[model samples]
Target: MEFSNTREFARSMDKEDPLATYKDEFIFPEVNNKKVIYFTGNSLGLQPKSAKKYVDEVMDDWANLAVEGHFYAEKPWWDYHERFSEKLAKVVGAKPPEITVMNTLTVNLHLLMVSFYRPDAKRYKIICEEKAFPSDQYMIASQVKFHGFNPEDAVVEVKKRAGENHFRTEDILKKIEEIGDECALVLFGGVNYYSGQVLDMETITRAGHEIGAKVGWDLAHAVGNIELKLHEWNVDFAAWCSYKYMNSGPGNASGCFINEKYHELKEIPRFEGWWGHSKERRFLMEPEFQPEPDAHAWQISNAPILALAPYLASLDMFEKVGMPALIEKRNKIVAYLEFVLHQIDEEVESDFEIITPSNQNERGTQLSVFLHGEGKELFNYLMKNGVIIDWREPNVIRLAPAPFYCSYEDMYEFGQILKRGILKI
Candidate 1:
């Protein structure tokens, strides 16, 4: 499967792509009456054209049913979040009983921490990857402080080897061993946000459990972008936002997976709320709490149907095109993107070092490139010329060519645009 950087070659690939038609399903932003070649699906996914219909249904329900919408609406508002369980379970590799749709990503992570990150007198340390997404950094630090421990001591970071862009699996296991009995929680982003490196979650989880530590993942970048097996990996918990590769609109609702092993365990403490209560006893409003015997047990508030609407819309798309097809396209498309980058680098005699792992298994849809011999000007050029990508600090461009909507032609088009930018043609 040789990749050539040519319009004909790209179009030939597109013609043969099974998922190629999906590009038409999304509404892309226009630049000079032309749709932009989007690559920032890692940051925020383009709106699904069907999303408006979903939102309209919710809005219409609110208008027509008023107070009775909870029970009378077409897709009843009362148990709307329940619609996501099986579909989301398929996405995250868990049973429906272990999946729940709830608050935004960080918010869900905070609530999950209360139940999983219970640092005690002897075991108070938390092990996480170095330079984790800033939100996770803040969450871990704040959680550590709330438990009356210094974040510097209690929050241990498994760092990459000096001069390396990615954290090695051996280094991570070694850190867990070093932390040993003092470690109470081991948390990491399933896929690193910066370098676009997919961490070894199965091995990490096994190692964490060996040390009597609770394991969790912030799958913000990993969820829809990569294949995951949270339950098979024996992960204690995991959370993800729907706005990125899930294509659920900006700042939409989140999804969570809590291992069913702890479903009704009395020893495990959770910040329970009304929605998390038993569905049967919910209307009873008893004075005591009896949580749902599933992942919904962590829900702190009622379903945000409006926010979850777009998510359900996207999940419906996931159902149509299962993960296997998406991953197949993802592998080929990402390799083509990498090949294009290399071709452009050679043609323009410019330094474009992709910091992302060369191995397809260790990377998702993103190629976080070190745009050497280029600067902010190159990023600006691409954006101005109808290419949408993400720029990180210093000099890095995170180009996540989402498979569902992004095409092989986009990779070729981006390469041409980049060549022109480099040569100022």
Candidate 2:
């Protein structure tokens, strides 16, 4: 794995990669007819070559079968949502019945919150990370406001020490203990979008339950990129968007999960719709809602077959590769990227830091680079040079070398581009 320089090492790794063939499965972006180094999968993944064909099937059903597509199409659009569950369950480590393809990520979060975030006067506070994704923050604030409470008083945000860039597990555990008695819920991103820090879900779940608080996860960045054990970890509920690592296209259908323990808990209130009704009685046009005995109970409307098709295709690919194998390969490639970045000399190192955790277990496929000066300028230079990493506001750039499409050569080329970009800054 040693490289004479970034270039030599990247070339050598690309030659030996067992998954090297996968790079060709995607349609790489071309600017002026040259393929760019694409490291922005954390933002939006490149399209799979087969995605159009996969989507075309659904389009065919819609065009030819129309409303009858619900039951008569080749894939039977009636059960199209079901087609994606098994494969997605494999990726997220959930039982098939415990998962469902449903609303978009933020919408699913709000739905789960409506069922889980029941705040009483004595335990009305919610605990979350300080820099949670904006959608999550907004959802929590709105939920608290809906419950007739001010977010300033009802939401307790956990933060790292002022000088520290990453969250420490000890600090998170301590904060949970400090607020446990008053907290009604603990919802956090499995892997933070900005810092790329992967929280210890098992430990956090246990701590929240011990304090009698419900716990959930926003897994938009974690799914497909990291291994999950939602059932074993006793996560009450979780939701994720599939547009990023899942390669399901922009603003695609999302998935939801509920722990099996909740299936029989009739006392827990839920937001109900006809889609969540038990299939046997759903056609009966019954007025009272009898939910499908598992996670599908959260669905609010009929499945979007076209949107679900892309997710099904993406999940099929994940099922073929298996999460453990994908993660193992991702670790090596990301580590290689880190090795190159660290070699960029003392001056460059002084100007930036890798805010993502150093331990492979503490992150997914992303590395969040924090720049000390001229952040936008550096980002613009890299983009203009055809190195497509994404820039977050203020001072950071997120580069994710996804296992499905990115190669070691892309990482090496990025290193060269980054070095040249910084010199101009």
TM-score of every prediction relative to native: 0.99, 0.97
* lDDT string, candidate 2, 336-400, tens digits: 88887877745365567899999888998999998877668888888888888888888899999
Error of 1 at 314 (Å): 0.6
The CA lDDT at 173 in model 2 is 86
Candidate 2 residue spans exceeding 4 A from truth: 346-350
Task: Evaluate model 1: give its TM-score.
Answer: 0.99
In candidate 1, which residue pairs clash?
none
Clashes counted in candidate 1 amount to 0
Task: Evaluate residue 254 in candidate 2 and report its C-alpha lDDT on the 0 to 100 scale.
Answer: 84
Cα RMSD (Å) between model 2 and the true structure? 1.5
- Give the range where candidate 1 is weakest over 10 consecutive residues by summed lDDT: 264-273
lDDT per model, in order? 0.93, 0.86
Candidate 2, lDDT over the whole model: 0.86
